[model samples]
Target: MLNRIETYYDAVPRSSARAEEFGPLTLFVQEGQGWPYYARPALGHEGDVPVAAVEKVRARQRELGVPEAFEWVAETTPGLRAAVEATGLTVHEHPLMVLEGEPLPVPEPEGFTVRLVGADDAALDTAVAAPFAAFDAPVAPGTSARVADRITAGLTRLAAALDATGSAHAAGQHQPVGTVTEVVGVGTVPAARRQGLGLAVTAALVADARAHGTELVFLTASDADVARLYGRLGFRTIATALIAEA
Candidate 1:
């Protein structure tokens, strides 16, 4: 699974329109959107990173007009975190998790119904707002349109939990969560917490992924408590991730 995750990480940059190769490292520049989309170092294989690799990465980020950030999976390339930190970049750690199991039923809590949503403007708005509200971050301009494009491209599957009045209460998505299907963006409104809406939306997407022939699923937990919540659905930590930024 670790090997597969490494391969997935390597392929992400290649999927972008603006990807440049630097030996084992790939730089993904998504017009300065942010981490994951911004300029970052992702290893294609385990090997000694050239002493000048860090300089080259920063140079490319400059050329692309994005901040120099390196998201490295330590399990994929041992010692990579230390190498990145040596370049004076701050590093943050996160749990890398994966799920593999037969489909498990997720009972929808009363007053909520989970279903797949299309790329319509209203649906997209609700889906995008859920995450922003949950994270306490202001919604960036053009986020909805960008996500709508991805959805139109058939690269994303969104699921939402609606109440009796058909109002969105919780939402999530399953897009190629990295080479493997992953449940991401699971969020519930403050008024909807402790009602199993998160589980409902997540399980709905998991079932959708399975129906589409995806076997292995993966996701990253924001913290240990969130990891424990996902554990209830059979996800387990398979590795750790390091996000280094200048």
Candidate 2:
């Protein structure tokens, strides 16, 4: 199962770059093209093996516009940590949690409902772009605009992919309080925060994934507080992925 977990992510790669398989080993370029992110490897298989593997992936990541990446060393396999460190890549430790057993409590807002998002739903489209509305902070105009553009573009692309893969959903009336796409983006309007809207939309998506026969649903959240909400819905941390500028 551990081995399969790595392969599952390798299969997706977050980008369009092809994943290469070499016996029990696999390599690929990460998508969304950025830094301080992971270049994952399965547990065990240490020493010269991962060194050679990283060399191969490093070249591939470079070709895909990434100069640096980290490997996710499972707590169960700390030996792989030493191997990764020896390969000249800095390593960090983080917990990997998983929620099993019964389903979590799925709460909905007083007057809203969770349902599938149509491609033409303006509320869903606006909620999808809500994250970008926070782009302008302590940063300058161009900085926020560029980041916001990337985020909007990424969400648009993801919405298209989810529709293609059959997993886009929306919540609320003509104007939604939140939106969620697969195991990806989940957000609500400022006025609607803490109203259980995010959890409701997320639960709907999880139900969709389970109905489709997917055993696991995962996501990476930079904010620990928001992650706690997901934790309540049976999403375990698994890993903390850090991102840095390229």
Model-by-model lDDT, in order? 0.73, 0.47
Question: Model 2, which residues run further than 4 Å from truth?
Answer: 20-27, 30-38, 42-56, 71-73, 83-95, 131-182, 188-192, 220-227, 235-246
Report the lDDT of model 2 for residue 140. 28
Backbone clashes in candidate 1 total 0
Per-residue CA lDDT of candidate 1, range 118-168, in tens? 877456687777766776777778777767777787677888888776677
Alpha-carbon runs more than 4 Å astray in model 1: 13-16, 31-36, 39-43, 177-179
* Winner by TM-score: 1
